[model samples]
Target: MANKKRQTEFLLMLDKYQGTIMKLCLVYTDRHPENVKDLYQEIVCNLWESYPRIRRKNNIPTWVYRVALYTAYTHQRSRKRSVPFIDLDDGFFETVASDSGNEMVERLYSLIDRLEPEDRTLLFLYIDNVSQVRIAEILDTTESAINHRIKRLKQKLKKMNENEEEQ
Candidate 1:
C-alpha cells in the first residue's frame, strides 16, 4: 500500500510537470515528434526509478531536467554508432511547419545541434527560463561555471549564425 501510494504521488507530480518535460524533449529532439516521444518515455522511466531518492519538492524540476538531458545524450550516442543520418527521415521540419508560428525555431535548433551536449543542455535550460543557480544545481556545477559556459556558448553560436548568413 505504501509503495502504491508513493507511485501515485510521483505520477501526480510528473503530471504537473508534463509540459516542461515535453518542451525539453522537443528542444533535445530538434522538434521531431517521434524522437520527442522516445526521449519523453526514457525520461519518465528514469524519473520513476529515481523517485524514491528525490526528497525535496524544490529539486524535482531540476532533477527531471537533468535526467531528460542525460537520456537524450545517451540516446544520441547510441544511435550514432548504429544508424547513419541518411537512414533516418528528418521529420522535424514537417512537424514544425504544421505546429509552430515562429520560423526561427528551426534555425535556432540547427544552431543548437552544432553545440556540444553540455552546452546544449545549458542553453536549453537557459532558453526555458531556468535560473543559473538552478542550472548549476542540476548540472552539479557552480553558478559561475554555468555563467561562463553560457557566455562562451552564446559567442560560438553568434559566430555560427554569422557564418551561415554569409553563405
Candidate 2:
C-alpha cells in the first residue's frame, strides 16, 4: 500500500510537470524528436529515483528543473562520443519545421541552438521567468553569478543575431 501510494503521487507529479519536462528536453536535444523522447525517459527515471527526497523540498519546480536539466546535460555529453544510436525516419526535421509557423520564433530558436549547453540552460531558465535567486539555487551558483551570466548571455545572443544578419 505504501508503495502504491508513492507510485500514485509520483504519477501525479510527473503529469503536472510533463510540459515543463518536455520543453527542457526539446531545447536540450536541439528539438530532435528521437533525442527528446530519449531525454524525457531519462529525466523521468532520474526524477523517480529522487522523488522521495524531492517531494520533501519546499519548491517543487526548482527541484524538477534541476533534475531535468542535469539529466539533459549528462545525456548530451555522453551522446557526443557515442555512435548515433537512433536513425529517425526521413522528413523528421521537415515535419518539425512545418509545425512552427513563426519566422522570428524560428530564428530565435536557431540562435539559441547555437549556444553552448550551459549557456542554453541558463537562458532557458531566465526566459521561463525563473527568478535569478531561484535560478541560482537550481544551478547551485550564487545569485550574483546568475546575474552576470545572464547579462553575458544576452550580449552573446545579440552578437549571434547580428552575425546571422550579416550572412
Candidate 3:
C-alpha cells in the first residue's frame, strides 16, 4: 500500500511537469518529433526507475531535469552513426512548420543542433529557466563555470547567426 501511494504520488508529480519535460525533449531533439517522443519516453522511464532512489536528499525537479538531460545526451550519442542527417518524420516537420514563433526560434534551435552533446545539454538547461545554481548542480559544475559556458555559447551562437545572415 505504501509503495502504491508513493508511486501514485510520483506519477502525479510527473503529470504536472509533463509539458516541461516535453518542451525540454523538443528543444534537445531539434524539434524532431519522432526523436522527441523517443526521448520523452526515455526520460519518463528513467525518472520512474530513479524515483525510489531520489529520496529527500535532492530537489526533485532538478533531479528529474538532470536525468532527462543525461538520457537525451546518451541517446543522441548512441544513435549518431545510425541516424541519418535528416531523419525527421513527416510529423516532426509538421510540428516545426506549425510553430508560430518568429524565425529566431528556428534559428536558435538550428544553432543548438550544431552544438556538441554536452554543449546542447548546457544550453537546454539554460533555456528552460533553470537557475545557474541548479544548472551547475545538474551538470556537476560550479556556477561560475556554468556562467562562463553560457557566455561563450551566446557569443558562438551570435557569430553563427551572423554568418548565416551573411550567406
Candidate 4:
C-alpha cells in the first residue's frame, strides 16, 4: 500500500512537470533525441531511488530539477561524444510552426548551446524563471555563485546579440 501510494505521488508530480523535465533532458543531452529519452528514463529512475529522502512536499520541482541535472552531468561525464544540440524533434517543429516566439526562442537556445554544461543548466533554470534561491538549491551551489554566474551569462549573451546586430 505504501509503495502504491508513493508511485501515485510520483506519477502526479511527473505529470505536473513533464514538459519542464523533458526540456531539461533536451538541454542536458545536447538535444539528441535518443539521449534525451535515455536521460529522461535515467531521471525517473533516480527520482524513484531518491524519493524516500524528500521531506518538503512544496519543493518537488527543485528536487526534480536537481536530480535531472545531476543525472545528466554524471551521464555526460561517464561517456563523451560531443554532440551538437541542433537536432530537432517533430514536436519541436510543431512548436516552431505554431508559435510566433519560434525565432527568438531558437536564437536564445543557439546562444545557450555554447555554454558549458553547468552554465547551460543554470541558463535553463534561469529561463524557466526560477527564483535564484531555488536555482542555487537545485544546483547545490551558493546563491552568490548563482548570481555571479548569471550576471556573467547575461553579459555573454548580450555580447553575442550585439555582435549579431553588428554583422
Measured by lDDT, the strongest candidate is 2
C-alpha-based local distance difference test score of model 3: 0.78
Candidate 1 root-mean-square deviation in Å: 3.9
lDDT of 4 by residue, 1-167 (tens): 99999999889888898888777766665455556666777888999899989999988988988888889889888648655454446564344233346688776667777888777887889888999999989888899999999999889878877998999
* Candidate 2: C-alpha lDDT: 0.81
RMSD of 3: 3.6
Whole-model Cα lDDT of every candidate shown, in order: 0.78, 0.81, 0.78, 0.78
TM-score for each candidate, following the candidate numbering? 0.83, 0.85, 0.81, 0.78
TM-score of 4: 0.78
Clashing pairs in 2: none
Candidate 3 lDDT score at position 104: 85
How should the candidates be ordered by lDDT, best one leading? 2, 4, 3, 1
lDDT of 1 by residue, 86-141 (tens): 22344653453245666687677677777787788888889889999999998999
* Model 2 per-residue lDDT tens digits across residues 1-167: 99899999889988999878977876777576666777888999999998887545568888999899889889999878776555575464336424367888777677678888889889888888888999999999999999899899889878977997899
- Backbone clashes in model 1: 0
Pitting candidate 1 against candidate 2, the one with the higher lDDT is 2
The list of candidate 2 runs beyond 4 A from truth reads 85-98
Displacement of the residue 49 alpha carbon in candidate 4, Å = 1.1
Clashing pairs in 3: none
